[model samples]
Target: MSNLATKKLSGLLLKQLGPHHLSSTSAFHTSISNATAENSKPMITGLFRTFILELRNHSTLSSDELMKPVQTSSHSAQGKSEDQKDQKAISSYWGIAPKKLTKEDGSAWRWNCFMPWDCYKADISIDVKKHHKPSNFMDKFAYWTVQTLKYPTYLFFQRRHVSHVLLLETVAAVPGMVGGMLLHCKSLRRFEHSGGWIKALLEEAENERMHLLTFIEVARPKLYERALIFAVQGMFFNAYFLTYIASPKLAHRIVGYLEEEAVNGYTEFLKDLENGTIENIPAPAIAIDYWCLSPDSTLRDVVTVVRADEAHHRDLNHYASDIQCQGLELKEAPAPLGYH
Candidate 1:
């Protein structure tokens, strides 16, 4: 018989309705509209002015262990401090690189990429200027990935299965999300942006690794289902990211939206940890959080730092909009989830 554990994840996802998410999204839409309103570019300096005050209450209170994040790093070379080393572990989960933009209203006319590469797949080592050169392997890889991951969000939405199914689903899904994030991180690397994003993704990747490992460690270890999830996530994200490189606008916004959502989920997870209401880490509800939010609780500081990366996503969205808006007039209406 199908246990309640499988259905449990679905129910938990439906329960969150908080102001941080609503306001942040709303603010995003409003800012986008303001930028393009009147065919005018507003000075972007003050856009993030109230960032700390605005989101402070929304942030989860930190634990004594996770207070610094520096104390959380794994062993590394160059003798970097723990925080710096820890920063190197979670690369893809941070959403610190370029983002994907989607219409909150669920409009299909989404922004694809900011720089417009077309994912032609030439030599992967080529500079951004040569991205359009089109290699057969890259194009083929992107296509396969999209086809495989066609149902990520949908599959994630499904409820009622088994404990092994849940573990398999989560293990499979996390890596795809991690890889998608890595592609974005690499985008920043290509653009010569700061190493901060790279560092963040590394940490996130580590987090994904932990979750995957944890699922594997479970008594059942549903290897077959887990494999399916991995393949789907891997394929979908690679293709999605290739498209993102090609268009780089709304695609990035989608990324930003997802990351922000992840942050919200992680922050909530920490809150649960604080309350005795969330007793065991392996509780079915907690497992859902593991699958959907972040899987890295080994270092509580990871939640704060990873969430900070989500906060920084707003800046990237603003930057991408500015870059992509070459004389295009932005309408003054807000879109769903804060797209204008």
Candidate 2:
């Protein structure tokens, strides 16, 4: 064929094939080159070179048209791009779209910190006064450690219940995350099931985080308090991580004692609310939804449920420590899933 005729043919072929077949054309060119190289046939090699020259010329001329389809695809992707832009500081190409959620009443679920299925009514009937007396050296050591931490915190926050509980929840959420993570690694290393303890501990962590979120709606922490939390969380997370690695028994025991202190703290908060020392304001909307409380529930009711939650946590940690004291791995016992 003449040079002009060959160029025309390649252009026509590209037009007929459309943009999607451009990659196939490149593949065909590659295969032809490989075949020509192997066969060392002069006629075939000449034809292949001519074809490559025509394709290159045609590609330059039709570049705009080829890019049209790509532009159309990019336009289609604009919606996803816009969605990602709307999300602050979170850009991902993983296509992990968020699901729209609604409450039973058909209202849009507002909280991303938790989902509807995570919400549950507190077992207010759980014995808040239940105390695990430290019988052994380990138990006593844990109790005193918590006590040593507790008195200083009480003196610092004084009767400022909101600030006190805010800090409490910050520290409270740590052990579960550390325990869950260590257990997860252990499960992977040992190539055995975690007896649901990983999920249980993670559940506790998320629950405690929800508590912090709920309280945040009620009271914005002071700058100093926020600084305190920053310092405390950094110190506590590393400390607890090391402690859990060294001795899970002692770690769990300490958490149990800490929960006991939390229960006491919230109890004191309730008493203040009851005596009108602190106003019994309407419960934060997050708290009401999280605890599945009545629409008209008050701060008093929120504190009641939160205290009950602490009690359950206290029991769970004490139970964990007790199991360890019996000289068995946590995996030996079935985890109390959804204990709170």
lDDT of 1: 0.39
In model 2, which runs have C-alpha deviations exceeding 4 angstroms? 1-95
lDDT of 2 by residue, 1-340 (tens): 4445544554575576566445434544454334433344543555456556656757665655543433476786996799777885644588666788999999999988788998999999999988999999998999999899888888999999999989999999999999999999999998999999999999899889888988888899999999999999999999999999999999999999999999999999999999999999999999999999999999999999989988999999999999999999899999999999
lDDT of 1 by residue, 233-327 (tens): 67656755565556544444444444444444545655654664444344332222332333344323333433454444433443333344454
TM-scores, all models, native as reference: 0.31, 0.77
Off by over 4 Å in 1: 1-225, 280-302, 313-318, 326-340
How well does model 2 score by local distance difference test?
0.86
Residues forming the 10-long window of minimal summed lDDT in candidate 2: 31-40
Q: Largest lDDT belongs to which candidate?
A: 2
Error of 1 at 39 (Å): 99
* 31: Cα error in model 1, Å: 95
lDDT of 2 at 294: 96
